[model samples]
Target: MWTKYSTLRATLKLHENADISQYGRLIAFLKNGSKNHKPKKAKVLEREHIQQFLVEAPNTKFSMMKVALLFGV
Candidate 1:
């Protein structure tokens, strides 16, 4: 059974996809959402990717690479 637990889930939804059904569900799910939240997925970074991102990254602190991956470079 692959049923979703509507009770224990956090109410954090975004209008990422333009689908009507998805957008409506997202609205219901995040109707009572909080400000502080974290995404479930973790970004994976390779040395090669970082090297490429560094070239186009702006500023020393917030670079394109840093924003690209949710994690660190």
Candidate 2:
């Protein structure tokens, strides 16, 4: 049986090599869209998909601005 602590420990170990800010950004993105909706599963993002996202994303939003800065596009 998987306990909450065990799950968290496993997840931390799994992502220990990953950038911590990326994790924070992902969690924030999930929380932002999770209101009155089910969260979607994670998948690898493709360049085309990201480009589409950037194009459709509102320019006035801070998150999109950060994304633009991060991707330099």
Candidate 3:
């Protein structure tokens, strides 16, 4: 069974040959948040999920700046 993450990596590799650097950044962001925030799963994340992350992130005991940087907000 293909896990969501494996599917995502395969999809990116198969169809997204351009903008490799941007994809690299996205992959890295999914794997590890900027310096403080916990990592989030990009494979199944939706818009609502992102919003939730943004909302709950600040409350965590991490640098606010780090969360902002992670989201580019």
Candidate 4:
């Protein structure tokens, strides 16, 4: 959504010569407003789950995916 907003702003600036300064208050609100803000709870993986993943990931065809997941985690 923020990306779309930035694209629109850029397009308007480049093609329409829009007066985007008039939208400063709106941009500020979108950036700092609490209305749509929600904290996501982190999901905890059990020891058994991690062990099973380690055992099974190597048997799959997605070897690169397994490597990426290992590094990412």
Q: For model 1, what is the C-alpha lDDT against the true structure?
A: 0.52
Instruction: Find the candidate with the highest lDDT and give its number.
Output: 4
All candidates: TM-score? 0.23, 0.32, 0.25, 0.42
Question: Model 4, range 13-67, lDDT digits (tens) per residue?
Answer: 8999985647888778777764677879999989888768877765558677667
lDDT by residue (12-53, candidate 3, tens digit) is: 778984334355666676557445655576787677876677
How far out, in Å, is residue 73 in model 3? 8.0
Better TM-score candidate (1, 3): 3
**Rank by lDDT (best first):** 4, 2, 3, 1
Of 1 and 3, the candidate ranking higher by lDDT: 3
| Count of clashing residue pairs in every prediction | 0, 0, 0, 0
Worst 10 residues of 3 by lDDT: 17-26
Q: What is the per-residue lDDT of model 1 for residues 1-73, given as tens digits with 9 covering 90 to 100? A: 0023342232222333233344566656665453445558988878888777666666686665466664654
Clashes of 4: 0
Q: Write the per-residue lDDT of candidate 2 for residues 1-73, one digit (tens) a residue.
A: 1244356656776888533334766567656765667558999879887777677777777575757657887
Off by over 4 Å in 3: 1-42, 58-60, 69-73
**Model 2, residue 51: C-alpha shift (Å):** 0.5
Q: Which pairs in model 1 have colliding backbones?
A: none
Q: Model 3 misses residue 8 by how many Å?
A: 26
73 Cα displacement, candidate 2 (Å): 15
For each candidate in the order shown, give its overall lDDT on alpha carbons. 0.52, 0.64, 0.62, 0.76
Q: Please give the TM-score that candidate 2 achieves against the real structure.
A: 0.32
